[model samples]
Target: MSENDETNLPVDAFEPNRERVKIDAGAFVQQGNTVYRIAQVLDFESIIGIAVETGRSTPLAVAELRPVATDKEPAAAPDLTEIADPDWREAERRFAAIQPLLGRYMVGRIEVAGRAKEIGVDTATLYRWLQRYRATESVVALIPKKRGWRTGQGRIPTFAEGVIDEVIRDFYLTAQRPSAQKAVIEVLRRCQQHGIDAPSPSTIRARLKAIPERERLRGRGYKEKAKNKFLPAAGNFPNADYPLAVVQIDHTPADIILVDDIHRKPIGRPWITLAIDVYSRMVVGYYLSFDAPSETSVAMCVAQAILPKEEWLLLHKVEAQWPVWGIPRMIHVDNGSDFRSDNFKQSCLAYGINLEFRPVKQPRYGGHIERALGSLLKEIHDLPGTTFSSIKDKEGYDPEKHATMTKTEFEEWLVALICKVYHERRHSTIGMSPLRKWEIGIFGNGEVQGVGLPQRPVDRLTVLLDFLPSFRRTIQTFGVTIEGMTYYAEALRPWINAEDKEAPGKKREFVFRRDPRDISAVWFRDPSLNQYFKIPFANQSLPAMSVWEYDQAKEKLRREGAKALNDVQILQAVTELRGKVEEATERTKKARRQAQRRREHEKNISPAAPILPVRSTPPTPSIASLGLLDIDTEDFGDIA
Candidate 1:
């Protein structure tokens, strides 16, 4: 196939193949198992013997390679320096303990091996140990042992016969119902006390995944859902930031989520909310929701985002004990309703922290929380489970029915476990885990405190308040008038007066100076009142008025209505002049009703006034006899 055709091939058709390439700094590529370092395509064929799986790169794998200093750090000579046998044995013991925890299907074995190398022993040593122990156990047992399948199907599994089942069961429980960090640590500590081997996060993740999907969700037949990422993760640093200044929030709906307390299944999707500290990527607050998350959730998230780590975990314990203070200096939030609420704003004000709203419709704006939720969702639900109930004869029926969920309930638990499982547990992003992230000052919570933004209060507020969009109202009753209401200062009132007919209409504006102490009141001037005064929102409602809206209305009809009413009144007066007075009031009421319906019908099709329902039949009024004034003096407050 042509390179373009290969690129077009379906993703499932793609297979991984490892290849090595000699490439210069910054040029990198990877195929299934091996990543090629190539300065150009020439290096692909000339340098590494491994074949490329595809013309293009597998993004997840390619993301791991860096071309800098591709020259290998010289291989070590056989270690002439002797270490104690016990030291090697301890390393060997740790390796043996987690070997069964590894999954065969996972794509990143090389990455896992890299982590092992960082732990003091290389991947080759670990493999040698697995083989060495197997041979030794066979000799000791005095039996001809059968070979074990690489894939775990029928088992030749146990070297320590009882330990495998026992460890698997305990590991399964943790996977089935993950405990808070404190609880998990306590369990691990207890295991240490009793001389049982404890598992690391990697092992815990893998073993927990081994439980049958149906069993994992505490039900029969459950398949997991996958999510996509818009951006790659940023590299990490141990001491990168100040505390409480930046927090990230994102939404994820839960899946194979709990159906009820006793029966859990993957039924539907739910919105999971989380706030993480930008510096450490430790989840500060989280909630999964079955409903459109409300302001209450936002307030709760703010509270958690600000508190200390251990205390944040206490919130999950049955016997809860935690502090209430420690609110952040500023919180990074999306423009969704929950975060945009007036109540949330007040909370920020009360705590003297700034609430920074992210751009509309962009999830990546809060990348830390966005990425963290994806990791948690994958860990708890998607990675391990493939198909729940795969019986051959059933027609179109998924055996995974028991694992299905409703979106609403999924949202509910998506919110609940955000704190219980995701936040209070260890964080893969920060790496100290959630519990350690707190004690380690990764948040810099106590040592590096958040500083609030300085406020420059302006008295006339129109100039300054306009910057923040306080509130706006129309010029309802022109001229100076107030009922103990505060008005915009006299100086800027004229420039903003809607009654300035000689000047341009677009130039008119109203700005309210919102005081944090008295948010309900804004300052605007009653032009006639010369003195500056404050106006409460109840007394003024200008901000929503739009010239485009009123311009779109039929103004000509308004003038015609005045003329028609005058003409009707004239005829009624003329009839009364001749002492032939008809019940004019009833006729006028009938005309008014007809006019209203006619106006409504014509509204959408055209702005033209409706055909007069009165027609020309039985003319009831004349233009001459309707005694009417042609001036608008409705608000002649001081006019003579």
Candidate 2:
């Protein structure tokens, strides 16, 4: 390997003191990538509890997990020497001898991630070796072979014969078709053409029942038992009657590759994000992105799903796939790192939408997204288009000249087809097309009224005033100016003055109450009484503020901008209004005094001028004279 390659092998991340292992090889598990509870060195027999995977071709993506310590104790490592027996023969025999030792050293009772042949030497031989050759005084006796599943009797091509084999392939590919029965009929016709005596079309009807192979393995996954079957559930979703109460989101690497349009060379594989309604099984939002699965893509999927076509058009006029569906009350996703990121959580928080996370690596909780990915992977893999390279073909194949193709275009074509086929096509379980189910409002509650979605305006601007570049010198005045626009908030003003202006650094700004009527996610601006506060921008702006522009500025750069204006400008705006409150308050007091005097005068009693309250006085101090030192006279005589 090149030195560069060696450098990139996670050498910087590895710590010598800990067992910081990076597994180099493993089969793709159908969820987030890393297999949990993996043992560094595994020894096992017959790969017991070996989960049967259906689609090895369309592998599921697992999250890239970095185990973080939240006050978590370091993982106790298994002592390797405990299992390596010097006296034992055959690896299986050695394991049998050290069963008790392995049990004590290993954290868990069951060991996962083992090679099948390493331990399983035909169950009988393994057992014989375990007892006679490898058993130690302290080791527990090996349990002899339990009845095997007996599944290895036949091979794949022979075992999955008849409609069962045909069904597995056809069911997944054409599950979204309008008439799945017709699809099965087509398969039967193909079989007949192959010289097999095919059954009549009517006779094929009853045989169709045997096509559901997946149904047999239905309840094989983990499920939680009900704590109280009769009790009403808490945290019940909004609108029990709505069809779109829950939505699940997931991202999978699209089969399509992005290519440079100018030079049709593959740039990279893009991602396809899917948002599906849990109730109607409707594809609410579908987005194709060249970037990694980020909160931006996730939020876009949600916005595209929730906002109506007109609203989307008002915001993004040119896009053709703008969604016209309703908002999902609950957004469910696997506990992937991206989904748990602050960017994603902030979006959820801003929208007041509930974000639900499935347990780590649990695809079954987010089964809708998983199933959608399954369909997408197959569809894209099967899609055909002319492949191209850079605009200038390096390989010498040129069309008019050296013409090339991009995978992005192929992906776009696939996306369109899949959306039409998978989304518009009928679902097997729902017994209706996604559009049909969506329109009729058939969801978790069995109601006719569809889900009511939340409306998030695109115009809301989020900014932190404390960090604003123009924040200093701008103080609480009778009024304040932001971006050259002035606003009148009566409650705010008067925190700016000569004292504030001459003071070093930033002076306090005005305190403004938040208008309850405002829908934008904004808080009232209160000038810091030596404390911090943030204000909202005007709900809408002709030119939208790029959220990053302010955040990206360096402290020195922002302070330079802040230095442009001083507290003097704020004093000018608000000093005139300062006397208004005090003067008004005094005038009211004087008027009350005058009225009371006039009432006394009318009663034929000359009221003495009401004395203003007498000021408090200080007590007088006693006085005395003091003496002085006499050394200066003698020094004057010596000088003379």
Candidate 3:
């Protein structure tokens, strides 16, 4: 075996003082190709118990194990080394005065005595100090020692401690509410019967107080109550000094009913993903979707926060300016799956953004974002289709009967209110409006300018495309098939049946990017030239529809007894369902609910989901396919 093999390596393979190679419990060690965590140190420096990934315990020799070192800083050594006992420093100081005389042997005891007198110490004490200082480099060695009985003062015998503990567990710590005085008497009786020394009542009382109240309560079978009563409240989260230092993201269901764009009927409440700058208390960006929170929703919300919104505001007809844009230093989030996803972590790492998760069950860490959501929802409670915030406030109020604004109208209204009203209103905490605070944070107090700077700008489309779901596919004779949809593009013709040179002996599989919102086309990157090409669906006659719409339509048809459903049949079903929802006059509750869901499904799908770099001229079927060229803008499809 090679020397790199951890299990086969000899004891001397590693250096004697390698800092990472620790033998303590809880340290990580590598054996062969597998890494094991040290569960316990069985013998001081000889044997240890290690737990594998599957939690199985295995015995390992200390010499055979090598500790694993990560990018984190090394474990700190004990801090007691620098400090010495009292009088150590004084003794060392006195010794320094007679050092020259002590070095000369010709100088007799009389000279040493004279030197000791000058330092205010007797000859014997001076010699003792010198002897201790020379033997042990630490000055602590010169201090007087606590000898004999002083070490055991006020201490109970081990056997007496055991007897007292037995009496306490059996009598004192029970649900019967036993008297402490009686428990102490019983402990004395038990110790006397066993011929062991009994602790005095005062000593017993002191020990009883030393036992934690929570532990006592738990011993009496009040575990939950004791925990609730004694557990400390979460500490306050420290505020950031500057804007964009830390941002928090959270999702809450909006407290209002929304209507369909076409039919003008009520749909369910939309989920709002809100991002806020903790320092300025300013709303950076938010996304409203009928779909539940997911990785896609998180990606879209982050993209909105990072990119410029001048064009988006104009399109939505909101006149207020929202200038916030930049990658935050760190993002604080809850332990939701969307926040924990690998995709989100990788994306944040790519932009040098740190991800911090709030401790589980600790709401104080995310109080800033939670309070922001609460305030926003409180404002929404006064709207036409308001749910009034809670069951108490919503009692006797019919939200659906009052519902009037469509999803699009609500979006426009929300943006305008956020920018024009909320941004201008004075915040109690900061003593200024969020917009004003942001201005001060970005600009200055008056004289000296702030040190804050905007992050490097990146292409908005590039970020959007990079976040989309990627799939692996081989360039087969039948073009590329994704989710049962075959896509074809003339640019793929030259690379057909090509083998991937990077992975020898493995079938060549290229990565394809897709936006689940619109299944009309997918983007493929040519590995050799490092350029992306869009390939539309094989059939040109099919109507453009969101993935949710198509899936819902297919499921509805299947429930209606249709078999062997095809894309054409599914499209026909979608059209039929849309018409029924729009024209129905007296519908059942179920049908109305289905119609609302359909409306939400369609409304959330954006027409601009995939924002890949576009080109005007097609590839010339020459070296141009392998060469690089600047990209131009082109619209792909709607975002689902």
- How much is 262 displaced in model 2, in angstroms? 1.3
How far is 181's C-alpha from truth in model 3 (Å)? 55
Candidate 3 lDDT, tens digit per residue, 1-640? 1233334321111111111133445655655545567676553224445445467778875434543333332221111111122232332333454454533425567876876655445577656555543322222333333243353233466677777678778888888757778888888999889898887786676456445566689877787888677543443244365778788999999999876654566766888999998877888878887767877677777877765565567757898777676667678899999888755664564344657888688677888899889889988988998998779998999998999877678888888878888888998877899888887776557763443334322234445554556666777776887766678888678778887565676657666776665567777765544456778877777665656667778789889999877667766897887678556623543355456555544343331222212211111111123222112111111111
How does each model score on TM-score? Answer: 0.28, 0.34, 0.55
List the candidate numbers ranked by TM-score, top first: 3, 2, 1
Q: How many residue pairs in model 2 have overlapping backbones?
A: 16
- How do the residues 279-345 of candidate 1 rate in per-residue lDDT, one tens digit apiece? 6455555644333465534544444444223322332232321211233545777777766755445
> Which candidate has the highest TM-score of all?
3
Q: Is candidate 1 or candidate 3 better by lDDT?
A: 3
Over 70-110, each residue of candidate 2 has an lDDT whose tens digit, in order, gives: 22222221111112222111122334323332312132223
- Against the reference, the lDDT scores of all candidates come to 0.36, 0.36, 0.61
Q: Global lDDT for candidate 3? A: 0.61
How many clashing residue pairs are found in candidate 1? 46
Query: Could you give me the TM-score of model 1 versus the true structure?
Result: 0.28
Off by over 4 Å in 3: 1-239, 446-449, 456-458, 553-640
Ranking by lDDT: 3, 2, 1
Model 2 segments more than 4 A misplaced: 1-241, 310-323, 384-415, 442-640
